[model samples]
Target chain A: MAANISEETLKVSYEQLSDLEKEFEENEVEIIRHQVALNKPLYEKREKILSELPGFWPLVLEQAPPDVDQYIQPSDSAVLLSSLKNLTVSHFEIDNGGKGDPRSIAIRLEFNENEYFEDAVLEKKLWHRRAKSGWTGLVSEPVPIRWKKPGKDLTQGLLDLVVKVWEEDKKRGPGAAPITKAKDYTPAQKELKKKIETVSMGGVSFFGWFGFRGFPISEEESRAATAKDRENRRLRAEGKAVPDDEDDEEDEDEDEDDDPYGLEIFPDGDELAIAISEDLWPSAIKYFTSAQETGDMSDIDFEDGMDEDDEDEEEEEEEAKGGKEPPAKKRKA
Target chain B: MAANISEETLKVSYEQLSDLEKEFEENEVEIIRHQVALNKPLYEKREKILSELPGFWPLVLEQAPPDVDQYIQPSDSAVLLSSLKNLTVSHFEIDNGGKGDPRSIAIRLEFNENEYFEDAVLEKKLWHRRAKSGWTGLVSEPVPIRWKKPGKDLTQGLLDLVVKVWEEDKKRGPGAAPITKAKDYTPAQKELKKKIETVSMGGVSFFGWFGFRGFPISEEESRAATAKDRENRRLRAEGKAVPDDEDDEEDEDEDEDDDPYGLEIFPDGDELAIAISEDLWPSAIKYFTSAQETGDMSDIDFEDGMDEDDEDEEEEEEEAKGGKEPPAKKRKA
Candidate 1:
């Protein structure tokens, strides 16, 4: 073992691995295509079966796997339990060739007549789009939940604020924009932000996730950033001058400091959606069945549990009582 | 949302969903087969590239993503850095058609001339087998490391005890035996257990993972259990008499109380192997490349950091400093 292992060797090896990784990614794309095709009938079958079982979706949410469950506030749970009629997850881009990502999904939640909202259906689309940093996952625009009354809003007004910001973002004409700075906010937006900050001191409601606009970078911007990153990495490997991402890092910190309502609502929204679509949706029947057998509907107190110091230990105890399992199922794309 | 949704409708819907889930699983299996084929040449290329770079595996281990890195002791790090020559992960069952699980992996570690062990290579094979609980994962019998001296043993003699116990298990005629009971332990076995308990107070070594025989249940037993569980669930759903698993749960607790050397060594061995094979192995180049540029060799202090109450906070700080990213990659199957 020598300390003199050349940087060139590592660079070459990394390049080779990157090429192999590309092949792996291509293989994944093919698998996603197949999965999209295969899931069509299963999803249809699921729809039929769920229709036969009233309160299926709501019950499933009550037993939501811990990751997604953490975001559900008491108010959100009440709304979902009372009104959520059907939940469907679909690969919306399946019909498109390679132009549209097959991993992109549409999550639709149908509601029966309820006091919470006027709309019968609330839908969110997540494009499996890449980020400037080369990481890729679900990206979406805010879908306003038409709350029937301010008192009935599960997000406690956070949803309205994010939706407003998103609508303002639409004026930028379909390109990636930097996260809105606090100083840049309109007076009304600032007032809404202040109100949301105070009201959502407990944390964002699960419904607020509908407003999640994953990494703000557009697809085109992401591609460019990815290319630039590659070039920089190559330079760094060669021990040549390479520009640092200090500016990007600073920007990220600034965005977090501002705590834009969308990001605040669900910083892990992309992953949450993935978990819901891939793990929770497919396994909803299991959760529903298990909850019914155990009579453990009272275990959905994630918001209260979040405030505890010994949350991990509390969760372990919950798991011991067969309350929930960590969402581990990842059936490909 | 009605409370009067019939149990029969729920049961029927569950059955349909289960059937749909099976289709999803079949699709997953197909994707895994394709991945296995696609990965073969890439792995071969990796082997070739690794040969050109000395100390690459050790360097990668130094930058091991947090989950795997947490198990590596300071002493283990010294041994690995000095002697670890090559690391290779392969799906051994790739050519076995449908008989063998394609997800089953063999992790091999080759050492150069070293003071720690006599063997040039240590290999552990994990069969992607199912447990009686219907959960499937990589399972293996212990692979003993031939340490040159007692002091050189990375597992602090825990491996030796497990190997003895495993040898004793071989005498039981190869059926699925319940976990070994403390009351049944031979005097020597009892003494060994005591010694291991005291010496391994710090926790199990990364090397200890080699002896991880997952779940301690045979594949035959698992299949039978799956069928029985299904039958029991149906019986329960029909409000008929169904045998409870309280006895099994008690047995599980009793087994844990005894702390069998194998289970004590690595309870999450199955998941660790999958993370290594699927996530770590593929991403080793990225880790190696980043580590070299950042010069962050000091960040691999997981074993020391484990004792602290602020371990999570410490990890966050480490991540902020570009120490390591949470292992998030899962290229499908």
Candidate 2:
């Protein structure tokens, strides 16, 4: 952003500027005065707006399903607060026109510290109605259901939009049952869109919010699904086909989309990893010893992934080797 | 903050309530549900308020004139963020209202790691319209001058609203010779009130903002005033006349009033102080040595208050005595 410097300037005497090393003299003062003239009242209005804020703004943001939007969670936002780049909590406040409907929040964000106020800040005063939810949200490109397919209910409309497209996907044989087989002929983007249409045909998608508290994906269930996705991804890459899972790869794909921008996760070798893990040996030994003494393994789950079978096998092996060897030593004793 | 428990009761089954051996399990769940019911709307509204807040609420509060009567500095406003409590720079935004009257801003604030959002945190909002210049201003209980002696203009109408009683303090005798004397007859509270009135009468009493930015009392100047107050108190108690300079005793009296709570200061003896000072000798020597080499003394201004007069005197005395005696004895060597 280039500064809008005015054509005319002012002068400063040497004595006046001496303390400040003749820096930003009266010329700056004049410029500032002109600038203030240009925009002083906004500063005044800013104070008024500040005073007008609802007291619960922070709480409103905090109460969002998983706290706030990624934009508000400075850690997750596209930009972080400067002054050495700290996180800026997304701040929001809802304006209810005397208990009226159509809820909307006035949102606030912090920009990169060096950015100008006009560029750095964002606020919307009007109360906005949030987008209606259906199967897989209508993102920003809100599909006009009536336009796409004339149906009474949004779900019916959306289904109408895609059901035929997907049912045809079932490529039925005459007098035989129908089945799904991904078409190679369709373009990748079209195929992908059709696939999404197929996945979202059944239930209402995006329950609580677009991404915050999803309807069908319970937190722990999501975790398990993620683990399955990771395993499936590994298996698929390895050419091990998992059957009947194609209809619901959407959850995994959506999960993958959550972390869209690939974080450059560099894997460090065991030189450092082993050194750190080895340093933990003394503590681990004491922990295992105590767990064995108390016969409690819940706290040691991560350290020892061994199940009862592994423990029993180890005991049997120890009996075969140590019991007989110790007997020979026992004769000497 | 008492919990509201309603008279109306609800019931549940034995199987449902049997978390314990016929204890309060059901009662707790019932009461909790009731409490949640009572408070859920408030919580919802709180979220709404949070969402409605001006983007720059915290910033505006940071700018308030400390008129809220809470003494929390930006650093000390209780709630500090924990990842750290490192002070982030304040952020602000101006609202122009498309260029309208009575401007405003939205401001934001940071909380300490553990503090909640409701703590007292506003300051610096006012572009304080300071009081115009005057000799002394009266606070509560403005005595009516007209009731005693009438002035052509108020001094009467001021007394009408209990405001202008202060504007007419200047009573000049026609052929008066200048005279000054501290009145001994007046009651102490009256005297104290008069003194306060005198201090506030000049150039916008609260130039900074109401209670936030007091006028003319630079932080250091206030400190000086407090010191002078302590000195004056000691002198007055001793019955020592400090000479008549009453008209401009803003330095001393104003200082005394600042610390209204009257902290019971008990001065510690110098013995412990000397012990602490003596222990620092080694570090001081090392510091000075390093400072001399690195030219780091520019950063330190506190330790070098002593002047050449004292050092020269010390050297001369040492030379006249120790040097002469040492030289006479050194002739043998």
Candidate 3:
């Protein structure tokens, strides 16, 4: 049947499939390469955070993932001085909570520790229930740490260590992907994004970025994970190291792998995805459509060196292409 | 650490965990039982729809899963008159898209065909662009439908068959889960749901319904899905179905299986989900939280038989129980 996704293109001609395929392959590698290069350090930080956060800041285990070691020990922070912005400490616990499995990090900062504390320890919990940008604090558990005396050298070591860790975290990691809530888009872009967000409020979901999309799995992943289900099934069949208790754990892993194609935004995307994307964001359609048409990415400026003069040519070419109905761009021989 | 997911009790009391567990176990079976009874016919329709829809609306193959047979002889519709509302046909296509491998169902409605036709097919694509109630349309391709002439006895039989199919579809089938765009929620419910929706817009997910909470996985389903995967894998191994071509499909299936509990709505719903749900839907929280406390579901009114008088008594009992923090409902023999 004739399909109309948007006014600009009533139907994607059958012939365009070849073009779309070519376009996808031509740029996917490079795009991924670029993303890899860009997100390499971030990914590393994410890994390190996964490893380090659980050991010291087990409360982070609630919001962030803990390595096997971290999970075993978990975080039991005695003095949790959160929201250190201008010394506005939120929650400080005497009996550090490290016992709970799969702990939740978000807690209403309580003032219960005031009675147990000495006169010198004046602590306040920051709710942050309405904290704006650049004001958000990390969920942490600095367990087993006695609040060091202000002048005590013992406290300095703890303070310095905490400082170093905090500085490292400030660099942005997985738990805080695109951290600090920095608005990267322009005002117009922000408005457009808001509109998109409003429109996409429905319970649309992508399962997880585990197997579907190559989301940089590390060596330290759980034994239940990393090992393929087939391998696990084989091990179980062989009567070797098949843990029954971790059935829930394996189920948890599958949950992460829920998304059909591991596509974060697009659901079951193909040419249909192209149509949706084109319809939703018509302005950006040219990049995908034109690229598909000319499987020759020779015209694509990955370097973005297209000058003003070339922009005019691009528009004229687009107009001429649009005039050719049913099929916009022909197969480049 | 103590997690306070509800205002009634800030932290999920340890004692309540037992009660909650009991409630979940007791009510879950019954809730699911109730659902089973209510949706028995719907489920049958769902099965029938899965079987028969592909025979006619194989275009649904793009959106729905293709049975093994559908992969062999796909739909080849010559004429498609879509809209039944005032014969306002939206997309009418002659050459249904079925040639491409692992085809994407997106089509372009040709204006040229309008002039060629006998002043009949004037179709308009419903983007649902402005027709909000949270809906939007995507263009699709349906092929291999044999066209029936307008006034032929043979066409009458075909039309009768189509009518029967449509009548079956009218009942809420699995494929057509609550069609016709009716508002299922009241305004207050909508507002509350929006709040819940807003709070739960993260990348959280659940996996297969296995052993976390009893998520209704009969022994039969596992065998079937596992066998299918094994068969599919075997086919690939034998070069009968090398599915590098459909990389996305496998992933999508995983996404569907993300929630370990497979709590269709709640993704990886632990305490975080509880907090969100409680904060958003306080009225619903009693069922979940109290369920866990008693491990006893005597309080649960699954039948909705508790009238206004019983509702008052329930409230009084709840209040009386509330005073006993950390120990709400005692286990009833």
- Winner on lDDT between 1 and 2 is 1
- Kindly indicate the candidate among 1 and 2 with the higher DockQ: 1
- Tens digits of lDDT, candidate 1, A1-333: 343487677666666666555555656677768767766776787788778888787877766666567777777777788878888887777664445667788999898898888999999898876555455556788888888889888778777887876777677678645456777766656766687668667887888788777666576766676577667656755768867676568556544555333234556567678778877887776677655754544565543444433444554444323234433453111
Q: Point out where model 3 deviates above 4 Å.
A: A1-217, A222-224, A233-333, B1-146, B150-333
| Candidate models: Cα lDDT each | 0.68, 0.25, 0.26
Interface DockQ of each model: 0.32, 0.01, 0.01
Q: After superposition, how far is residue B114 of candidate 2 from its true place, in Å?
A: 45
| Correct interface contacts retained, every candidate | 0.42, 0.00, 0.00
Q: What TM-score would each prediction reach against the true structure? A: 0.76, 0.14, 0.17
Q: Which model is ahead, 1 or 3, in terms of TM-score?
A: 1
Clash pairs, model 1 backbone = none
Question: What is the per-residue lDDT of model 1 for residues B1-333, given as tens digits with 9 covering 90 to 100?
Answer: 353577677665766666555556656666777767766776777788778888778878866765576677777888888888888887777764544667778999888888888899989898865555455555689898888999888788888877887788788778746455677777656766686668668877888888777556676766676577667757755768877776467545544445433234566566567667876787777666654754555665543444433444554444333234433453111
lDDT digits (tens) for residues B77-188 of candidate 3: 2232131111111111211322211111112222222211232322221111101111111211111122233332212222233233334434545344222121443343
For residue B132, model 2's alpha carbon misses the true position, in angstroms, by: 44
lDDT of 2 by residue, B1-333 (tens): 011112221011111111111122223223323333343343343324323222212322222221121222333222221211111111111122122111111112233323222323222221111121211111111222222233332111222222221222123232332122233222432343354344334321111111211122122333354345445545654757655555355434543324311110101111111111222111222222222322233453322443434433433343322121111001000
Looking at model 1 chain A, report the run of 10 residues with the lowest lDDT sum. A324-333
Q: Using lDDT as the measure, what is the rank order of every candidate, best first?
A: 1, 3, 2
